[model samples]
Target: MIINKILNVDDYYFDVFMSISESLTGFSVNELQSTGLAEIYYKHILGQIEAATFTEFLNISKNILENSYTQDQLNNAIAAEIFANASTEDIANSIITLWYLGTWEGAYVNDLSYKEGLVWNVMHSHPPGAKQPGYKSWGVKPVNSNI
Candidate 1:
């Protein structure tokens, strides 16, 4: 889609985004995409006209990864980049939060699971206001026995 162009980042950038995002959020790239976190992140950045900020963040991060710097140096620099500008910082947090919770920061928690969001999947529960597990399913103890 056009997002592929708007993001316009190289494979290196995507790889880094996936790596650092995984490291920061503890979610696999598959989870991110399956939960629509990636798309939401793109929409959030594009909505804020912060795509350039994201691109710049990725560029800087990739550069750091390619350097002979210490992990502390890389981590510190990336942290600085994210926090250096409030706008980029917001975007950065939004990306991580989206991956973890499957929703935007300002959005209602229920709205996050409006569809088959990651939270519901990970929690083994249905989305709030979407559907119930059936009237007695909640009390059924789930069949697997592991909770």
Candidate 2:
């Protein structure tokens, strides 16, 4: 029998949370990491939900990731396994909202979170106040903007 020894427990949990977030949000690990909110989100989740529920959710996510064969299969598994349950669904939804809107339960985590929201990038734009595209830039078609 192999023994599991995790010296850095927080890091391990963060890794698992990140993997689950990647699957739930359809974003790459790098993209999630780029936001610099992985740890913050993890902490927020831990604070918002019970520890036992979060642990079980992580385990289910691990199993789903291990068993899934394709994107469609993974999505199906996620919907059936995660979204079907009320507690897990709440957590999953919160995670998605956090990524897209940079808020947890309708409250922004921080200034960086507002600026780094994935929705802005998904639309090939930046936050309104932060990262302004320059004066009158909107009048001309953006170069190489696929959108």
Candidate 3:
């Protein structure tokens, strides 16, 4: 049987958020060995990103960054805006993580279940050609393996 695939906004937000965060922080996606405050901040940023799609998150983050808020303050502000009505901490955390990831300069496609054909199509459409300098690479692969 063929499995129907539907893209989730939260997943898209997470991918984009990670890309942006890496760009802004100058950290490789796999090299973010964060803990404590950095970890907390990451979570919050992700939350904000997950709460909104790429375009919405970008607009919100741009507005916040242009203001005088510190990184922490900006993160919280984004969380508040994204989770205006939601009360779940998990959702909030996701939003925070999303925001942190969105700071970078690339698109994210974190859906593991996506078909290879579909992923390639999306990647080609967004980037249009070979990978550019300072942008995260996109493709399909396992995050970890024990083979």
Candidate 4:
């Protein structure tokens, strides 16, 4: 008997995270996973829930991970807010900023994933019909190629 393999929820989350990161930053899982910011964000996600709720937590985590923030601006804003007794307005602003940051990051990740996916699709696609003499010549060729 043969056993079929299936991706677990955690695996799926990681896959999605990697895909988004690659799309946004051109970094692979191995490279980005250890980055200081990524690690901090990852720990934040991991610490917020138990194992049983991992799948549900993953959606929110994914959103956070994929969100983008300008390093300089985020650092400045964080520094300013670090010692202040934040008011409701400040808190609201912070939340809004974070949400926007997440969206920006998500878009970057999505764009990179889209670009990589397009490349992959083009590389592995099948023509609608039988292979023709000129079928393989359709893609963008190198300038140096003597086609």
Which prediction has the highest lDDT against the true structure? 2
Distance from true location, Cα of 89 in model 3, Å: 10
Could you say which candidate leads in TM-score?
2
Q: Compose the digit string of candidate 3's lDDT tens values, residues 27-133.
A: 54444323113343345444545544445655544454455246576556655664453533333344333333322223332322112112233234332343242
- What's each prediction's TM-score? 0.55, 0.83, 0.27, 0.23
Task: List model 2 lDDT by residue over 1-147, tens digit each.
Answer: 111221244456667777778888889878988888777778888888799899999888878877887888888999999999998898899889999999988899889899999998888788998888779987878658677
After superposition, which runs of candidate 1 have C-alpha atoms over 4 Å from their true positions? Answer: 1-16, 64-87, 108-113, 116-124, 131-136, 140-147
For candidate 3, the clash count comes to: 28
Clashes of each: 0, 0, 28, 5
Model 2 TM-score, all chains together: 0.83
Give lDDT: candidate 2, residue 138. Answer: 75
Tell me how candidate 3 scores on lDDT: 0.39
Query: Model 1, residue 90: displacement in angstroms?
Result: 2.2
lDDT tens digits, residue span 1-147, model 4: 111122233446555434334333444445444332343333333454354454443443344344425545433443343214344223233222222232222343222223233223324532234333265556756445698
When 1 and 3 are scored with lDDT, the better candidate is 1
Instruction: Decide which is better by lDDT, 3 or 4.
Output: 3
Q: Runs in model 3 with CA error above 4 Å?
A: 1-53, 85-147
For 31-138, candidate 1 gives per-residue lDDT tens digits of 665654454455454565456777887766566556525657756766776667786577667766666565666563345445645556667777667767887676
